[model samples]
Target: MAARVGLNGQAPRCDHIDLLPAVEPGLPECKECLALGQAWTLLLVCLTCGWVACSDDSPGGHAREHYRETDHPVVAALAPETAWRWCYVHGRIV
Candidate 1:
């Protein structure tokens, strides 16, 4: 795999990519999605601190919230069949 680089051009280590189980280990099922009954098409993974949150503009804004609360450094687009991570601190696509 030719590591995908983020904006900063630094390639993130693929070893950090974690495969979440069907039932997420620690994340709470999106309540906003449940209340509005909307299903999320994509999930956001925080590479800076390894936090997983819903995408921006969602009811929870979990991803953004994570950034706000934790100040984690990076986040990447999480997909079932993909392995890639993004670093927020360096503004790179590693």
Candidate 2:
């Protein structure tokens, strides 16, 4: 999907981007799902602390849960070739 752009034709900036960890904490899979013996459809990396969790489409909405509990505002897809980020507060891709 095309990113949402601002009046300047640039992708809209998310304030939470500042919260992204200096070192990306992305994982190949959701450790939470692995520990629970559950299958996950997609993986997301919390930009704030590098918490890896399953996407909302999975059995456990762990990524959303992490945001709910910690108020971490951003996440990025952990899958290969996917370069996009989501801002929970804006409810949109950033």
For candidate 1, write residues 13-85 as lDDT tens digits: 5333343223332353444466667766556776644456677656567676677777665565666667655
Give one digit per residue, the lDDT tens place, for model 2 in 14-89.
6577656665776678878889999999889887888899999999989999999999999889865888888989
RMSD of 2: 5.0
Backbone Cα, N, C clashes tallied per candidate = 12, 0
The candidate that wins on TM-score is 2
Winning model by lDDT: 2
Let me know the TM-score candidate 2 reaches against the reference structure: 0.78
Off by over 4 Å in 2: 1-12
Global CA lDDT computed for model 1: 0.57
The 10-residue segment of model 1 with minimum total lDDT is 16-25
lDDT of 2 at 67: 95
